[model samples]
Target: MDWQKNLLIAAIIAVLFMLVIRWNDFQESLPAANAPVSSAQQTDFNASSDAATAGDIPSLPGTTQAVPVANSTSTNVIKVVTDSLVIEIDPQGGDIVHVALPRHYDALNTPDVPFVLLDNRDHHTYVAQSGLIGANGTDSAAGRPLFTSAQTEYRLADGENQLNVDLVFQQGQTTITKRFVFTRNEYLVNVDYLIDNRSDSVWSGNLYGQIKRDSQSFHKVSALEMNPFLGAAITTNDENYKKLTFKDLNESEFRTVKQGGWVAMVQHYFVSAWVPDANQENNYHLRRIGNQDIYLLGFTGPRVEVAAGSTGSLSTSFYAGPKDTERLAEISRYLDLTVDYGWLWWIAKPLFWLLKFIHSFVNNWGLAIIGLTLVVKAVFFHLSATSYRSMARMRKLAPKLADLKERYGDDRQKMSQEMMKLYKTEKVNPLGGCLPILVQMPVFLALYWTLMESVELRHSPFFLWITDLSVKDPYFVLPLIMGLTMWLQMKLNPTPPDPMQARIMQLMPVVFTFLFLWFPAGLVLYWVTNNTLGILQQWYITRQIEKADTTA
Candidate 1:
C-alpha cells in the first residue's frame, strides 16, 4: 500500500519533470506577434523591391556602406530544379529567395506539393542573401548589382551528378561570376564569387552571407502540443552551440567572432545554415531589423583583395534541408546540434541511433519504436525485478496491514510506527518501487525528444489509419490501447490501503489517456508497448512470489 503511494508520487514527479523542460522551450518558441507595419515600414517591406538597406549589412574596416537586397522581379528570378530540391534565385544579388523540398511533401494529402522552406512571398518573408561588400564592392547603398544568367530556368538532367548555375555581373574592366553548385541527392549548395579584376587598381571586398526572416512561425501548434524552437542558432568559440531567439535579438544585438563557425536559422525539423571556410576567421551577427519583426543571422568573412590582372574566388556553403544528423555533421562541426534533443542529448543520440538501426532491418518506424521499447525494458529487467519483488512482498503483507489498521482505528502515529515495524520485519522497502521509475525518467524523456525531433518520422506511416507517425493518431486507437495497458499494469501492483489514495491511483490511467490523445502516435505506441511489457513482467513476478508463499 505504501509502495503504491510512492508509485503515484513518482509518476507525478516524472510528469512535472518533463513539463519543466517543455515549458522552457515553449516560452522561447513564442514569437512576437506580427506587428502592424507603419507606412514607412510597409515601404521598407515592399514585396516588389525586397532590397536591404546599408544598415542591414556588416561593414568592412574602411567601408561604411554595405549589403544590398535582391530585387524580386520575375525577370531577375532564375528557377533551378534537381532531384531533391526546387530553388529560386534572384540575379539582382545572386540570392536564394525560395526553396522547396520535392522529397518532403507539404502535407500528407498533397502528395505532389512540395514543402516550401524559404519563401519571399507577400505573407511570409524568409530568404538566404549573400554579397560582396567594402571598397570597390558592386553592392552599395544605391542598389544591388543586377547580374545576368544565360537562361531563366535550369533542370538537373537524369544521370547528372552535379548542376551549376552561374550569374555574371560586369563593371569597367572587372567581371564577377556568382556560381551555385548543387549535387544530386544533397541539400548543400556551394556559392562561389569568382572575381577577375583587370583594372589598374586592386579590387577589395568582404564576402557576407546571411539568412533574413520574419518572426512568424510557419507551423501551427496546438495547445496540447509542445512548441518546437523557431529561432537562430550558431557555434561560438566558448560554446559549441547557442540559440538566439527573436526576442533576444529584439532586446539586443548579438555579435561574436570565431574561427569559421556557422550561423543558422533553425525550425521544427529543418535548418538553413551558412558554413564558411573553416580555416578563416569569420564574424557572426544576429539582430532584429529597425523596429520590425524581421531578424538576420549572418557571417562576414575577411576582406579579399584580387590584384590587377589576376583572378581569385571566395566561397561559402549554404545548407537548406531536413535536419539529417549524419549529413549535417558531415557539413560542419556541431551543425548536427541543430537537431536539438534538449539538454539530455547524450542519451537521446544513442536512442535515435538504436531506433534507426532497428528501423533499417524492420523497414517500419512503428515496429522500430516497439523494438526500441523492448530493448529498453530488457536493459532494466534486473532493477525492475528488484522493484516488483519488493511490491510482491508488500502485497503479501496487505492483510496484516489491514488488521493493524482495524486494531488502531484512530491512532495515526501508532499506525505509522507499527507499519514501519511490519515493513522492517517483512524485509520489504516501501520506497523500492519508486527507485526504478525515478531511474528510468531520463530514458523516457530522451525517447520523447527523439520521437519529436527526428525528421525521419515525419510523414512516415504505421499500419491502418496511422498515416503519419509524427502527428496524433487519427482514430485514437493507440492512445486507448496505452490506457488499457497502463490499467492492467496498475492491477498487477498492490492496491493502496487508503480509499482516497486508491481512487487517485485508479484515475491515473484515465488522466494519462486523455493527455496522450493528442500526442504523436509513435510516442503513444511506445507507451502501450512499455506498459504491456511491464504488466507481463510484474504479473509473472507476483505469481512466483505467491506460489512460494503457498508452498511454505
Candidate 2:
C-alpha cells in the first residue's frame, strides 16, 4: 500500500530527528584516533601537579605580565551544611572542593546517600576554585594562600534563613575574608571577598572564579542510551549560550570579555556555574590545563582596588545543584539555557510548561504525560480527521485495490497506472495516512528531549511498579504495551500488496519496541498513549466509512 511506503518514510524521519540536531555534538565528543594516552598518576588536591598556576588565571585586560604563585601549605577542610546543600571548602584557597545535594539521592536504592556534584578525591578532581589574581594577588604560579576558619564544621540552624561561613587569610598588613553565604533552601552561594587593607599602599587584584574538572564522565550510560552533554558552557555578549566540549578545549582556548555572564560545567541532570557581578566587565576563559585531561571554565572580574587603611568587597555567586530552569533564569540572563532542549526549544518549552502545569494538578508525571498527549491530540484533531477520512476512503477501496493487483499480476506499469486511477476516482490520497505522523514528529521529538532534560521528572513516580520516570521501565512493561498499540494501529490501516513491504512494515513495531526498551519511562509512556489514541481514532474513522459504503 502507498500508506506503508509513507509510513516507512515517516518512521525514518522520526528516528533521525534528534540525531540530526545533535550531530555536531556527537562529532565533537568523538575521541581522536591518534590522541596520545597520558600515563600520569591521579593526585589529590594537595598534591595535584595540575594545580593552579599563573597561566591558569586570565591576565589583566591588556597586560601579559606573569604573577608569582605564593608559597603556602595545606590547611584544614571546612564543612558547611544547609537544608539543601552540603559543601566542603579547602582553606588553602577557600575553594569549594566537594559539594553534595542533601535533597537529591545518589541512587534510587541509596536514600541516605546524597548526590555528589563536585569532588576532589584522588580519583576525581572536579571542584570550584576562586581567588585573587593580579600584580597584588595572593595566589600565584607556585601555590595558593592558606586561610583559617573559625570552625571545622558549620550547620544552618533551624528557623534561620541564612548562614555565613567565613575563611580569613592574612598577608602582611592586609586581611582578606572569604565569606560564603548560604540560604536555608537555596543552592546559590554568595561568595564575597571582604578586603580590609591596612597597609599604606593600595590593594589591587582581580577576583577570578572557575570550575576545574577532568574529562571523565561520572555517570555511566550504555552505548544505546542517549549521552547527555558532559562539558563546559558559557553565556557571551554575542550569543546567549554556547558550549565547549572537552575536545574543543583541547583543540583551542576560548576567551571572551563580557559585562556580565556565567560559565558552567554541565552534566546529565545537574550543573555548577559561577555568575559574576552583573555590572562588572569580566573575562571568561575555557581551556585545558597543560597536557593533562583537566579542563577549566571560569571568569575573572575587572580589577578591584582598595585604598590604604580602607575596606572594599568583591562578590560573585556559585550555584551547584539540579538544572531547575526557573531558578537558574533568576540567577543569570541565559543560565536557564543550560537545560538544553536542542533546536526545537521553541516547541519543547511550551510542551514542558504544559506538562508542568498538568503535573501541578495531577501530581504524577505519568498522568501528566497522558494529559499532555490528549491536549496535543486535540490540538491536531481536525488535521488528523482529514487524514483519517482520506485513509478511511482508501480502506473502503482496499478490496477493489486487491482485485486490480490480482488482475494485473506481473504487469508492474499497468498495476501502477490502475492504482493511480483508482485513487483519483475514489478521491483518496494514497499518502494521507502518513500526514498525522509527519506533523506530530516534531512534538514527539520535543517531548523526548523535555523528558530527558527535566530534572523534576527524575525519580518521579506514576503508579504501581512504575518508579523513576527518568530511567527506563525496569520490567519493560511500557515498551511492550507501546509496541502492541503500534501493531494494532498498523492493523487498522490497509495492508500493503507486496509481501516484502508488508513484512518490513510488520517488523517495524518490534524494531521500535527494542529501541524504546532503554528510553526513559516518561517518554515511553507518552509514545504508548499517543499510539493507543491513534489506533482508536483510525478504527473509528475506518468503521464509519465502511458502514456508510455498506449502506450505500
Candidate 3:
C-alpha cells in the first residue's frame, strides 16, 4: 500500500480496535456475579452489628468457624492501620485492613476502601460465629466453598486468639492444604499445599484453586438509589465484585480467550491466588461480580498420578495488590506490551519518567505527575513547532488549491492529480503533516494504560478537587483546557476546502471535550499539552520552510 494509504489504514485500525474492544466489553460484562440478595437477608444485615447477638452475624465463606479463640484480646488482635500496610499475626484470626484510603466515604465521590478481609478477623462480618468458616451466601456468589478453620495450636506460643489460620481439606487418604501463610505488602502471596496420598495403590487426581468469592465494597444507599453501577445489577445474595472460574489446564470443552489468558480477570485492580490441580474435571467454573454467565480463567499445569503412601507438595502465590506501572513493566514482557493505553502516554510517561528522575529529587507520585507535564512541554518544542508550521502552511496553500480546483472544473481526479503536481513543483509534501500525529499514538496509549492501571497512581492526588487521576475529571477544568487547545490548534491549521467538512471538524474539539469529561484528569492534561505542542511545531515548520523558499 502507498504510505498515505498505509497511514490511513493504521489510523482506521486503531479506531476500529478501540470500538470493537468497547463492544466486546458489553458482550461480556464481568462474569456471572452471585445472586443479588433476598429481601429477608437484606433485612437481617440491616438490623445491627452482630456484636450484641449470637447467630445474628453471617458465617465466614466456606468452613464453619473454628471454636473462637478463648482469649478476648486476641480475637481482635489486628491493629487498624491508617498510613501503611500493617500485618499482625498471632495464633488467633488476623485482621487485614488496607487503611490506605478514608475509612468513611460517600459511595459516589470517593473511591472504595481498598481491603480484602481473607476471613473477617474480628467476625464483624460473621458476628457471634466463633468457630468454623461460614458461608457468605447460600449460593456460589458468596465465594467459592472456602474452608477457613483456625485453631490456636501450641506451635507458635504467642497466646493471642491462639489462632492459626489454615484453609485446607483432609479426607481419609488425601489431604489438601491450600492456605497457610500470612500477609503480603507487595509482589505475591505464597501458599503451601501438602497433599498426602495414603491409599495402598496409586492414587491420581487433579487438584484445584478456584476463586469462590471476590468482593467489592458498596455504598449502603436507600431503596431509591439502586442501579447496578451502584447496586441494581448484582444478584440477591452476591453484591461485590466476585467470580468463580476453573483452573485452566487442558479443558477443551471450554473455549479460551487468547488475549487476556490466565490474567484476564486482573486489570487495574490486584488479583493473585494459588491452588493445586484438582482433577475434578467438572469443577471448572468462571463467574464475575455482576454477570451470570460462568467463564473460567485458570491454569492446569502438569497432571498428577501419585504412587501409594507418598506425599506431594505444591507452592503457589496469590497477588491481591494494586498494579504498579514500572514494577509490572519489569514483572513480565506481556505486562509491558499491554501498557499500550492510548495517546495520553506521549504526555504522561515522560511526566512520570521525569518525576521518577526528580523522584530522585523528591520522591512523591503526586509531585511527579506535575513535574512530568512540565518536562514534556520543554522537550517537544521543536515537534510542536513543525506541527504548527505544517498546519499554517496548509492554510497559506488552501486558497491556491481552491483556485486550481475552480479552474479545473468538476474533474476531481484531474484536479487532485494537478494539485499533487503543483504541490511537488512547489516543494510541498501534501501529506507531510500526518507522520508526527501517527507516531505519538502508541506512546500516548502506553502512558494511558500506565496511569490507569498503575497502583502508584491509585489514590495519589495533584492538589484539591483533582484528587484521583484514574477516575473521571471532577471539576472539568482539564477537559476544558483540552478542548480549548484543540480549538487553537485548528485556528493555526489549514482549512479544508469543504466548508461543511470544516464545520464538522470544528465541532470535533467539543465532541472530544465532552467525551473526555468522563476520562481521568491526567489523561486530559496530556492531550491538552500535546495539542499545544503540535501547534507550536506546525508554526515553526511553516516559518522555516517559507524563509528558505523566499530566499530561493
Q: Specify the highest-TM-score model's number.
A: 1
Q: Ten consecutive residues with minimal summed lDDT in candidate 2? A: 26-35
Q: Show the lowest summed lDDT stretch of 10 residues, model 3.
A: 227-236
Please give the distance, in angstroms, between residue 225's alpha carbon in candidate 2 and its true position after superposition: 0.7
lDDT of each: 0.86, 0.84, 0.44
Ranked by TM-score, the better of candidates 1 and 3 is 1
Output the better candidate (2/3) by lDDT: 2
**Considering TM-score, where higher is better, how would the candidates rank from best to worst?**
1, 2, 3
RMSD of 3: 10.7
For model 2, state the Cα shift of residue 465 in Å: 1.4
The residue-by-residue lDDT of candidate 1 on 8-71, one tens digit each, is 6767757766744664444334332344556775665673234433356666644453444443
TM-scores for all candidates: the values are: 0.93, 0.92, 0.59
TM-score of 2: 0.92
Q: Where does candidate 3 stray beyond 4 Å?
A: 1-112, 116-179, 193-207, 213-264, 275-314, 325-387, 409-414, 540-552
Model 3, total clashes? 77
Backbone Cα, N, C clashes tallied per candidate:
1, 4, 77
Estimate, for each residue in 369-425, the C-alpha lDDT of model 3 and write its tens digit.
555555665665555455555566667788887898588757766776777787777
Best candidate (score: lDDT)? 1
After aligning candidate 3 to the native by TM-score, how far in Å is the CA of 441 from where it should be? 2.1
